[model samples]
Target: MHPGVKTKEPDKMSPPEKMFPVLLQKNYVPQGEYEIVGYLKEAVKVKNAVGQMVIVEPEEFVKGEMKPHESPGVGFGPMEMKDGRKVNAKIWAGTTIKVPVAEAKYVVAKKIAERADDIAA
Candidate 1:
C-alpha cells in the first residue's frame, strides 16, 4: 500500500462502555427497576419506577431509605389586620421540617452494559 493511499478496515473494538451507578432519592427504598433520564459532567438524572427524577453522582449508586436529621426552629407569620389597619399580633410558634438524605454508595460494574451511554444515571 502506498503512503498516500489508505485502506478501509472495520474498527477492532466498539465504543467503550459508560457504566454508571445511579442513586435514588426516595422516601422508601424498594428494590426495583430504575432508569437514567439525563446526564451531566459530574452528575446524572435518574428516573425511578414511580416516575420520580433524582440527580446523583456519575459513578455512585445509592439504594436505601433516607435518614432523618431534624433541627428545631421557630417560625412567625405575617402581621394581623385590625379595622383595615396593620396591628401587632401575638407571635405564633411553628416548626419547619426538611427531607432526609441518603448515603451514597459506589457500585462496581461487573460487565459491559449495552447502550450505557444513553442512560444518564
Candidate 2:
C-alpha cells in the first residue's frame, strides 16, 4: 500500500454496451436471465460442467463465428449497487451460456407485433 499512489476506478455509471436478451438454460447452474452485454475483452474462467473447468479466452469470446447471431455468454453471481464500494460477481460457466436469439421465440414475437399493426389500422 502506497500513500502517494492513487488508483483509477471504473466508470460505474457509464452506459452499458449494446445488449441483447439471452437465455440461460434452466439446466445450467446459477440459472437466471442474462444478456449478451458484449464480448469479453479479458480472459475469464468458467465451470463448463461438473468437475470440469474451461477458460474462455478473449479470442474465443466472439460473436457470429459459432453459427451466426449466437454468441457465448457468462453468468454472474451477486453484485452490490451502492457507490464507493467495489464488488465483482462470483462468475461461473453455469452450464455454459449459449446466448443467441431463439428463432422460435422470434416467430411468436413477430405474430404478436403484427397485432399492433392491425390495431393501428
Candidate 3:
C-alpha cells in the first residue's frame, strides 16, 4: 500500500460486491430502472416557475436508458400539453425540469420509481 493511502481489512462476514452509484434528485426524472445503491449526491432546491421551487441536481445511475417509454398507439413522438407545448420523450440524463410543487410532492414521488419499468412489451 502507498504511504499516502490507507487500507482496511475486509469484513469477515460480508464479501465486497461490485457497487454502482445512483442519483435521485427531486425535480429530475430517473432514466430507467436501476438498483440504487445509495445517495451519491443530495437534492438541492432551485427556483422554478412563479412562486415554486424544484430540485435541480444530477444523480449517478448505472445501465439505464435516458429515454422515456412511449405508449402504444400514441400518435407521433413526444408529448403535448394543454398549453400547446411539447414534452419530449427523450430527456437528457442529468437534466432537471420544473414541476408544480404540489404535483411534485404527490405525483412525482410515486412515478419516478416506476418510470424505468414503464416500457411497452
TM-score for every candidate vs. truth? Answer: 0.18, 0.17, 0.21
lDDT of each: 0.32, 0.37, 0.40
lDDT of 3 by residue, 9-121 (tens): 78778753332232223324323322323222345678877868787775443233332223554332356799997664433333233333343344345654212222412
lDDT of 2 by residue, 1-121 (tens): 6999989988879763332333222222222333332232345678865867678764444542211222456435446677755454432321223322353244225442111112334
Over 1-121, each residue of candidate 1 has an lDDT whose tens digit, in order, gives 7999889999999774343433323222212222223222335789988999887656432323222223345332234475675442222111111111111122113111212224545
The predicted structure with the larger lDDT, 1 or 2, is 2
Q: After superposition, how far is residue 63 of candidate 1 from its true place, in Å?
A: 12
Better of 1 and 3 by TM-score: 3
Best by lDDT: 3
Error of 2 at 59 (Å): 30
The lDDT-based order of candidates, best leading, equals 3, 2, 1
- Lowest summed lDDT across 10 adjacent residues in model 3 is found at 32-41
Instruction: Rank the models by TM-score, top first.
Output: 3, 1, 2
